[model samples]
Target: MTKDKTGRLHVTVRSGRKRKLSSKLWLERQLNDPYVVRAKREGFRSRAAYKLKEIDDKYKLLKPGMAVVDLGAAPGGWSQIAAAKVGAVDRKGRVVAIDLLEMAEIPGVIFAQLDFLDDEAPEKLRAMLGGGADLVMSDMAANTTGHRKTDQLRIVGLVETAAAFACEVLKPGGAFLAKVFQSGAEAELLAQLKRDFTTIRHVKPAASRQDSSERYLLATGFRGQQRP
Candidate 1:
């Protein structure tokens, strides 16, 4: 069970006569969600698009003609926004998106269907990009195992792997973005980002559920090979 700002428990066991209650409640919440309504009205693939938008707004990291890689990009919301914002005119701007799930094709973005944890994934991504990236954004979250600590660790591993890949491929002064739950594991990643980047901060977008613990880490000014 999670507690909201009002200090009320927002989740309950779905047992006996309440077996369907939890699912129904979730559906009700999604239907009534303002972000969901806005996403539908605006024809965005998912509400998660606003998360990247807000982060980019604060950090001023996105710009025209930048080479970007989107990790765990499924259903194509972030990729769609990135393709346009990065200036895909005549493919001068490049956006490469990868995920384990099949995604509907978004014009002007390269989509790779592969698990990022696979050893071959990075090579394939670079092959698609034809060079290193200027920005690597990861919304990758491990599939939840229902155990709190295990789930947290799994996501931390995902974030760390993405960050390591970014360090290898991002240009000097590049940016890296990844999703993280507000957990103790974030401290180590934050510390590492601070060491390699000029600035690092956590951001929670308004499009995110107010009750959710999810937040984004924005790291800019990649030290790259210059790190002492």
Candidate 2:
């Protein structure tokens, strides 16, 4: 980072001989991202914390005494925010987290190293929560194959699965939030969400990069409708 003539700060990462150009670019982006610096200063797990905070701030999705579930909560960024907002640290609410990767453990969150698609996930999360949840959020993304259509389908598939699980475990009037791509949900999935939830919308937080295709799907007012 350096200051130029006008005193504006600039950061550029020159590609090293051994470092791939892609890696250098990614590193440069991270270096220039203000949210990354803010997250480090605030002790949040990742810059993604701000993405949830921005959504929840505007939507008021999280509240004290609201049980929440965070799927694919590795590194626990969203889980940390959810725990704080719901007062899980004070035992006012519970946060049950599921991920295939291990997490370092947050005070208000109970974690399990298991795939969310596992047959027993719903029951296990319910038992951990002692009942239904007020919200279920996921930031999970499938490994990209670099094919645009295939990647888009993979993203929507993850959202659909998470939404279905949210319906299964959320109490009536609960909410669901998950990452979706620019393509958004397919017609059939969108129709299913409309049937299950009172409202559905797309959100893009300031923390998300402008050029990125990532967006969030927020569905609120779960009807508790039975799903086959």
Candidate 3:
């Protein structure tokens, strides 16, 4: 680590001989990222917490007593912010997290290690909430295959699935937020959300890397499904 002429500290990865170029660059970025540093200092699980924090701070989507569900919540960074914002600690709210990988326990958060696309996952999450959620959010991303088009499709597909599940499990007037790459492939998903929700928009938090294409798609005021 060395201070630049501007007095900003910089970390350079010197393990190039043992690490692939990609791995070395990623390690150096993680080490120097201000959000990662702050997350460590603040005791959050990961730097992702700031992404959600900045969005919710401006939108005021989270409130005390809101029932929330977090999808793909491994590492539990977003869950930590949601738990505090919704007052989950005192039971003033409920938070249910779903992920294929196991997540350590977090107070006021109900964790179920399962694929959210499983046939029973939606109903199962609703059961855990004892009814419906006021908000459903996901930071899920599909694994990349190194091909840009294929990766874009996977990201959109995952977001589409998460949005569908959110529609099923959220109460009337609820909100949905999920991470999406800035791709035109989401036209169909956006069209569906426009019909199901009263408002839709994209949010990019400062914590997200500036070069990344990621943006959170937010749909609010669900109109509720029709009942026969």
Candidate 4:
């Protein structure tokens, strides 16, 4: 197994029998994925960790003592990275992770079993973080419906909601990152983020599947109605 800068791990899979087209394709891709191999070697939870790690390497958002909130943190890959980047035991450093699915515990992360769409979720996360966040990231995507348009809209909704909550909890000069589909329907959300942030950009992590329509929004420099 080999891990890449993007955090995807590649594994060898025996193609003993001709399987269904999708299964065969998936198996072949996994076998060729370098990041997958690397993650396994490095003891990371998933290749997704490389996505956040690469982003942070370029953006410098994950600081040693920054407070962070992670949405859809199941399996805790992102949380693990956050805990390490933020120095779990360091003063004024912490990570708050939320997901509907149960995640294995990771050191230095506060885990919550709740859906980000839930009405009470935002307040609950803030309570866990003990106040405003320096960064709020969401790798959340709705379970695919196999219907392209529907899946895109659902993911967009999740991104929009995450952005709204980011405005609520982020400190000035904070950053927000959320998964988004590249269907070009995110104009309104992008515009809003630009208004509230100093800069907004779209990023496609190398770990993300090329065939997949997913991308990420990187918004920085929060400028909203301040909440003390």
Q: Highest lDDT: which candidate?
A: 3
User: By TM-score, highest first, what's the ranking?
Assistant: 3, 2, 4, 1
The model with the greatest TM-score is 3
lDDT of 4 by residue, 151-202 (tens): 7778788788899888878888899999888885777888888888999888
Model 1: runs farther than 4 Å from truth? 1-19, 226-228
Off by over 4 Å in 4: 1-19, 226-228
Higher-lDDT candidate of 1 and 2: 2
What global local distance difference test value does model 3 have?
Answer: 0.92
Candidate 2 stretches greater than 4 Å from native:
4-8, 225-228
TM-score of each: 0.86, 0.95, 0.96, 0.87
Superposed Cα RMSD, model 1: 5.2
TM-score of 1: 0.86
What's the lDDT for residue 192 in model 1?
Answer: 80
- What clash pairs does model 1 have? none
Error of model 1, residue 123, in angstroms: 2.5
- Candidate 2 displacement at residue 160 in angstroms: 0.8
Error of 1 at 174 (Å): 0.8
Give the per-residue lDDT of model 2 (tens digit) for 1-228. 797677867698988899999999899888877899899999999999999999999999999999999999999999999999999999998999989988997998999999888888888888899989899999998899999889888888888888888888898899999998887447777888999999999899998989988888899999985232
How does candidate 4 score on lDDT? Answer: 0.84
* Reference-based lDDT, each prediction: 0.83, 0.89, 0.92, 0.84
Give the better candidate number (1 or 2) by TM-score: 2
